[model samples]
Target: MKKAIFLMVLALVFLTPQLSVHADGPDQMIIINKVNNQLYYFDDGTLIRQFPVATGKEDTPTPEGAFTLANKIKNRPWYKENIPGGAANNPLGKRWLGLKVGHNRGHMYGIHGNIRESSIGKYVTNGCIRMHNNDVYWLFNQVAVGTPVIVTRFQGNVEEFAARSGYHVMTWDGEMVDEFQIGRVETLRPMKLYSYNEKGEPIAMQWVPANTRYQVYATDGKGTYTVGSNKYLLYTTPNDTKYELVPSYIKR
Candidate 1:
């Protein structure tokens, strides 16, 4: 639980200026789900606010990941397209909690207010997380930058659910590579490994946390390929390169 808290703290601390540098901000937490069309706010496990929300269409379902507040824009334009400034008729009612995930082109995903209160609790938007205009207005005023924004499957064992990822290391040049695939768990969280060198001698052993970053290198030229995170089977080149799991390089 301390590690989980540390990870959350790391997420909050690394989330950029939206939270850290803000002035006169309250320490609040946000929970949003497109699956349930609900938005929740809490302070230290005490529910402080709750509201109905609208979600993305089935075809354009909102992505599932951990994100943080990137920025806040009030009364902003809906998108480029000369789409008229956000106002009474605008879909982005009053606030946009820009997501920490990268957007293609100029696309943006936000926890924004919507003009269509009637559409609350239903799938209605392109891909943004939506809330009732009044509720968003309230959120806009309350949520501070750096507040943790978890956009995930909305339900299920969020803590247990693991992402499909894998990694392999080269001993000679000491290069590590990560491979990501869909619907695989062999490379899921809580990784454990033991590494040996060319003489079949144990060099090092370690455990890796999911979504954490790490790396390793061999000072000796004769390293060996050891075990790998589940799904991936490693093969070395003819040059006697070694591979093994290293704590350095696993990342979120």
Candidate 2:
């Protein structure tokens, strides 16, 4: 009962939910969902802002991972295009949140404002995430260096996605995730769909059919998978007394 505050609040709010970051935990976090083409910003576990964003095309998919804000830059120069920082024609735009995806620590790719406002919400970046000029400026001011940055492509609201991904959530949920690949899970026996409490702990919601299959949203890398809207299925622990549940993953 003391583990799922994030999920319950999100279920209630449906749009924005606040999560309290524990000691040494990052109070500021940014999540970029390529599938939805949206960006969510959280401060001290509370959702502060969100905006439409543009990500990489299929051929140049954004590198998905749990990164940190390596640096913050205003009017960052577009070196490849030879456009100076603060240039009206620069593609990097008015602000930059350097997402450290590799050894380069995001000097190569990051979240930045786009020269083309119409590109927001579309799949068009070379690899970096794109936001509106003003939106990026707002985001750049909201967080400091070393903030957590998660880039994923899962299908769910922020709370469910983060909780299921094991972001300091309740229960046996394991290590935090950088990204979520689509997955298929087969239920061995009948299982009740579960919801989390205010503390982020699981509470049985309703009974689901036996031997059924579901395309889950995200896994804790332990066993539980988010199967439905704010719903979870503990596939590893079944009522049938047989342990035959097998999960498969798809490359997102």
Query: CA lDDT of 130 in candidate 2?
Result: 90
Q: What is the lDDT of residue 179 in candidate 1?
A: 42
Worst 10-residue lDDT window, candidate 1 = 163-172
Q: How far in Å is the alpha carbon of 158 misplaced in model 1? A: 10
Per-residue error (Å), model 2, residue 91 = 0.5
- Give the alpha carbon lDDT tens digit for every residue of 16-49 in model 1: 1221112122344465655567776644323466
How large is the C-alpha RMSD of every model relative to the true structure? 15.6, 13.7
lDDT of 1: 0.50
Q: Once superposed on the true structure, which residue ranges of model 1 sit more than 4 Å away at CA?
A: 1-4, 8-27, 103-107, 154-252
TM-score of 2: 0.57
Per-residue error for 44 in candidate 1, Å, reads 3.6
Identify the leading candidate in terms of TM-score.
2
**lDDT tens digits, residue span 122-227, model 2:** 8888999998988888888878887767776666556555544334331111212223424446677666778888998888887777676555567766676776
TM-score of each: 0.50, 0.57
